[model samples]
Target: MQNDIIKCGLTEQTDSQFVDSIEKEAYVWYEKNWKHDDYEHSHHRSQLTFVEEGYQYFHIDQKIYLVPQNHIIWIPSGKLHKITSEAQTVNLMVFLFKSVFKDDFYRDLQVFAVSAVLKEMLLYASKWSQSVTEDEEQDIFFKAILKSLPNFCKESNFLEIPVPKDERLIPVCHYINVNFKYNLDIDSLAEKGKMSVRSLQRIFKNETGITLQKYHQLIRILKSIELIDTKQYTLSQIAYLVGYQSLSAFTSSYFSIMKSKPKINKK
Candidate 1:
């Protein structure tokens, strides 16, 4: 139930030092069992998160994203976010200041599929705490990994949910993002979107592939994850922030969706 904060600096001879030796390099791989008391606030850093085991909900801006094994979450520098994991899971994380990578490489925040090569590279980087002599090799390998990242523009249509092109749905989705804390339902959302309930439901389902209620749940859960990952607020505080009437209700819904209780750790 303790909140642990480990800052990796270049001058420090800790596990993060191997990463620190490389200009703009920051990487850490560790296992931890996090409890309800562990909450974190968002801070500025370009980060890449890869989960080798378990499931997690990641919240960024007002969107909730489901992350599973071999799936990576990339946080742009300065973007606010949090994470909530299903259990004690093995996760590999790389943090960079963005200035380290070439300018064009760091343009957007995205989650990409991890290839076998990238996975092995992560494994090597995780072992950095064990060897300082591998600093040169690690630096070269890290750059190669970054260079191998697929450009978004080239494969923009891959696995990403495109924002609706419809103008009517735009304002509705925007309102939902801004007011997720409110009890928003089809009727209320329809009224706000200036459409009939039936039409709203149809359009929303077509655009997002889920019902309105389910979508809202997804959004709420994602937000909760962000709050947890960043250590920004307590579980009770996050529960209320996402519009749950009770902590138990929030916990139940979270477990139902993620298939496990909220816990964070290295697998």
Candidate 2:
């Protein structure tokens, strides 16, 4: 694979007595600069990608998911997806063999909130030596991680920008992605897509699984999230930049989408 990050693989072998067992393996990547995989690919093993710093954008299931710092994206085995990293991103991806998780429990791609404990555990797991044996102390730690996986896993309520397969909708999706800061309405978007307002609404709902207004709202909130920690911009400025006319309305909408208040650390 063509990547800008440095990657390493760690493997654990089992003794002959455990012939039925699958070997435990992990591939760790530390990304520094921005990069992207424009093509889709799938892995035989399940993947847990953790964002330690910075953020990443993932294209999966015809939707765009913005994975910010401290979040985890759980990709099931054989799930086709692509990823683009933001500048100075440092992330780790743990590739687990099929036997690591039951099929029913991890059959789809998901985003999860990472607790402090889970973060530490993932860090520790990434450091396991290649000579790791089945009975080592790390083995017990790995087992504990496996036991805790189900409890830690959850579906994130983050903003998802669904991309429709229809070619006509491509221009509309692109417009929302690039010009989210501008005033946009269904009628204007319909005109841009060269379709009637009702046809645009129907096609957008059918293709993206979200109404046009909600999708626009999601993009605005997502943009605010990206700008929250910039320090150069005040909360009010950030809100206005993302198309919200009122700070109160922006805060309310932000809290609704992010499930938390926006933290500002201006200098």
Candidate 3:
């Protein structure tokens, strides 16, 4: 049965608010549930998700990302993806439309390693949510959070997953990067890696803190984002190119993993 606790769609703004002298609307939500569910597709808005507590996973194409505390996920506009989390997960999510920030400054989604100052900013924003009167202060805090994002062009090893030094999983990992668009499963991947499925599962989790399927999903989603960002393809076309047959199916799966849709820039 499909999980229904987590709802998906565009976030609504009850009122227009400006942050950091930037006139952009925002949506903040706090949820507790067994899982977060959403459809796969692209959107016109960029998003930032902060995981304060509990375990969550993001499937970006074929690579599975383990989201724990003190980490943020940035989803650029028009990138199709989805997100799921275990029960009792608390998150601070920020959404921004393209028209809000300056072109050069806020052109993409960036995952920033949380800093002490940024943490405090999130705390303040949460508190401010209880009182609408703190608009100015809230705006300041939100702007600071946006400014803290690591620019996409900036090279930072911190933004990457730590591929364990395990020699066994190396081939599996390499194969994933090379063949993410192909239909693959743990059993096939294990055979390709020359290991038993159970052994591969245990080793992968032990090394990457995520299962083999999840790892592949993350890589696939990330690659999908890259294609959307670099090439000109319709959402439907992208879905098939990435191994999804039905556009609706692809969109649903994508949203379930990326938490936001792929951003497509107009030519």
Candidate 4:
């Protein structure tokens, strides 16, 4: 019993150090899997993050990104971001880049669909102990993969929802999130939050950079992604669960955001 307690203490210490290193932007953090909760930090080097098993959410550039499995998220250097997940085990792979590549694509955040080719390339590159290698052959292979990212990752994902900056709209946003599995109209949402329709529409758009209707759609679709990842329900059931009366509406919303068909992202 004492040994178990000591081991847990050590784990907590390691996790704390991990956050410190990341905050200083001095670490090249990559592993086959990690058991962690939502924490905010940044890195000196750019990152290519993919989830092989479970889904995770990222709060970046004041937007909430739902990164379901099989999707790749590109984070540029010095971007303050926080990651969160509810899955018991999140099997993720992160590739850190010490040197910035010469591409405008590398300058901003992009979460895109991971092609089979890109997935194999990322997995193969994961063998390296260091992201910046000195071995001539390995360096050449790595450069090749880096150069090919733009070609392989052309489809831009739309899973991003802007985070609210207005304090007044917090409860309103919460109401939409909590009741996303129902037909939530703007008038009712405004009434629930004790705001006029005009004020609610204007403030929501200003703070979140999206209208209340769009925000509602995003929340519902985001919930559906989580439900789909569980693999416990059928697509029809998932659509209904997320408050879509018809599977067609759910599919349309999902494809609009994810740029792909809904399926479990497993090889």
Candidate 5:
């Protein structure tokens, strides 16, 4: 076990024990730069992961969620999850809540956008060391974050892509992810799966709960979000890079999923 791992309040074991056994009601881990290679585990405490810089890929329940900067990920207690650190360095902060109030936020894994206020609060909370025991002042502060946490989840839910369990569509999913930059018509995609268009669509929808076309668009939009953060490409260039022919078409699709105009974050 590396000293940094222990310093960050994470048990050396990837698969954390799920017993009723958290020492405190709440605690925090910050300045966590250690990388876990597809660390799949679940524990008794609900966890919140925030990135101070860079993004990470979190695989939860056979789905892939990308947590970019200004976003947060919530993993409910006992939900099996894996964190795949990207090749780039990621500054991650994780908080565990052993005792939580009854709320829908803690029931499922989600990656959502948060307001600047909430981000600042979390950054401030990171000042406490992981070794710090339960204290009244710290407990009250965590309670306040928990109370306002729900309000911070004010974004749409199109950020994640469900991993298809069907053996037939597994290769198909991989193809789409790698070839998203090119124009992907249904006919070719169906051919790639070695099935008829109708059968492919049915299985794709059944496994992912999203239509083939919609899933394709969702991938493009997710890619565009990453491009947007780079501050290097214009909207038109990003749209073109992500397989869209025109800016308006890309904007329409992004707005439909995100429920807002594309606003570039200057920070």
Candidate 6:
């Protein structure tokens, strides 16, 4: 218990100096079929996590992100989040104290692409001992990494899966998740939630940071990606399978969300 506490940046007090004070640190875990089910919590520092082997699910601020392998997940300081995984995974979590960043530090959850160079750097950082040595070479190395973070972020729309905190919206979100293939609209969702269209619109937009219609589209897009991975569904088939009646419309929406056209491989 004490070891876990100290590793997680919690500390006890001592006479002259505080025990377990950390500036920057990293911890890596390799697990087979690992799963964590913890309530939402916050940290005093920002965190960058690399999913090396399998995917991870992060619930933050009533939104869920499916961070797949070889991706990076950034949770800014004080943001409430919880993580869970159901597959064999290797996760490297690097915690950077707020003091390390000078200004314009990220304040929200961000999932972005990780470059090969950045991946190597994170791997090396994770190998550092608990008691990091204060050396000039280490200082230069960490400084370079801090300066490179913003550039590492992929300039693309992330999958912010809706998980509303409002009790009224929970059932609505679930319905949309399961029935994304159906033609869903604000009115349908409003009716399902027993609220006026305008009221539902306001609440959904406020809680999810997206309109009801757009959120539905995002759900379909995420589902389409999963289907695409099977290598069985043609682009047109996937389009209709995820609720897009028109092939052209589905292609446009897929391209808009994925920033690329859907590829159908011929086997």
TM-score, each model? 0.52, 0.80, 0.46, 0.82, 0.84, 0.70
Clashes of each: 13, 0, 38, 0, 0, 0
Residue runs of model 5 more than 4 Å from their true location after superposition: 1-7, 14-22, 32-36, 85-89, 129-131, 229-232, 260-267
lDDT for each residue of candidate 4 in 1-267, tens digit (9 for 90 to 100): 111121111122322222122222111234555765456555456777878777888988778888877778888877877888876557777766656677898897888778898888777766763333255655666667667878877656467878787777888888889999877677877886688989889888878777888888889888887887777788999999999988888898888777777875443
lDDT of 6 at 198: 90
Lowest lDDT 10-residue stretch of candidate 2: 11-20
2 or 6: which has the higher TM-score?
2
Q: How close is candidate 4 to the true structure, as a TM-score?
A: 0.82
Q: Per-candidate RMSD vs. true structure? A: 10.4, 5.9, 16.9, 5.2, 3.2, 5.5
How well is each residue in 101-196 modelled by candidate 5, as lDDT tens digits?
A: 788776867678768899888988888747457688888988898778887786546777788888889778778888888866788888888999
Tens-digit lDDT string for candidate 2 (33-126): 4355555656466667777666677898888887776788877766777776543434444435444655466676777668889988877766
Which whole-number lDDT from 0 to 100 does residue 44 have in model 3? 59
CA lDDT of each prediction against the hidden true structure: 0.60, 0.68, 0.58, 0.71, 0.76, 0.68
lDDT of 3 by residue, 1-267 (tens): 232222223442222111232333544444434345444434555666777754456666544455545567777665666565542434544434343456554654455456677667666666544232336665666666666555422322223354756787778888888988887777777886689998888888887776667666666655665556444688788888787787787777667565545555554
Per-residue lDDT tens digits of candidate 1, residues 173-235?
A: 777777788887677778877999999999878876767777667667766765666555777
* Candidates 1 and 6 compared by lDDT, better number: 6
Which segments of candidate 1 are over 4 A away from where they belong? 1-24, 32-40, 88-90, 103-105, 130-134, 151-195, 198-267
Model 5 lDDT on a 0 to 1 scale: 0.76
Pairs of residues at least 3 apart in sequence or in different chains that clash in candidate 4: none
Predicted model with the maximum TM-score: 5
In model 4, the runs with Cα more than 4 Å from the true position are 1-30, 129-133, 155-157, 264-267
Query: Which of the two, 2 or 3, has more lDDT?
Result: 2
How displaced is residue 188 in candidate 4, in Å?
3.1
Candidate 2 stretches with Cα past 4 Å from truth are: 1-38, 93-95, 129-135, 264-267
